[model samples]
Target: MNKMHDFEASLQVLRGSETDITSEVNVIKTAVASANKRTAIRFQELNQKKFRMPLILGIGLLVLQQLSGINAILFYAGSIFKTAGLTNSNLAACGVGAIALLATGVTTWLLDRAGRRILLIVTSSSL
Candidate 1:
């Protein structure tokens, strides 16, 4: 057998299994080769027509998020609360900070489960 088959056979022996793993090894090899080839061709693939829409949308969303004044609002939240006539403006600012922290924690948990697109849509719509 070839090197890959030899490796697979050795692994099977180490695992103390008599069942054949040739098909599994071939599948894994095929997937690895495809991944390597894709990496080599990635830049050329990026210039294709099919990739334009997603690229434009991704960049546009990032630019819009930066331009939305969210950072300024967060940074100056205490001043904003004071200006808005809150008697305990510091407390209000702290509340805002706490909420932001909680939201970040929730987002971290939900990101893998709900995915990027869903999270982006929910956040954008809420804002």
Candidate 2:
């Protein structure tokens, strides 16, 4: 895990037009494989004791994140821009994605720092 993180840190340094993508991607693939091995071993160890709760939560999050409506929002992002009162939806969708990304970051950051009630209030007020 530590080595994988270090590899990723180095990979980031190779970004931009000057970087060789094929080699970089190969390195990333190797890092990913290492990470997968570590994850499999960790899970196998945890299976001996108690891994149910966190595993269930992870699977639930995965299912929720990939639900039809979430995919619909991604597929119909252009429509969302128009629905949000933008004239040029193609361009507006990019802005919408940026805003959504920022909102996700902020919400995740506030999840523990701010209570659920206050978080809902802030989100609702923004909407």
Q: How high a TM-score does candidate 2 get?
A: 0.46
TM-score of each: 0.49, 0.46
- Report clash pairs, candidate 2: none
* Backbone clash count, each prediction separately: 0, 0
lDDT of 1 by residue, 1-127 (tens): 2487678878789656977777777787888788767335477687899998888888988888788988899888889999999999889989998998998999899998999999888877876
State which candidate has the highest TM-score: 1
Indicate the TM-score of model 1: 0.49
Candidate 2 lDDT over 27-91, as tens digits, reads 76887778777434464565654677777756865775675366788779998888889889988
Local accuracy by lDDT, each model: 0.83, 0.72
CA RMSD for every model?
Answer: 6.5, 13.7
Off by over 4 Å in 1: 1-58, 125-127
Strongest candidate by lDDT? 1
**Alpha-carbon deviation at 28 in model 2, angstroms:** 27
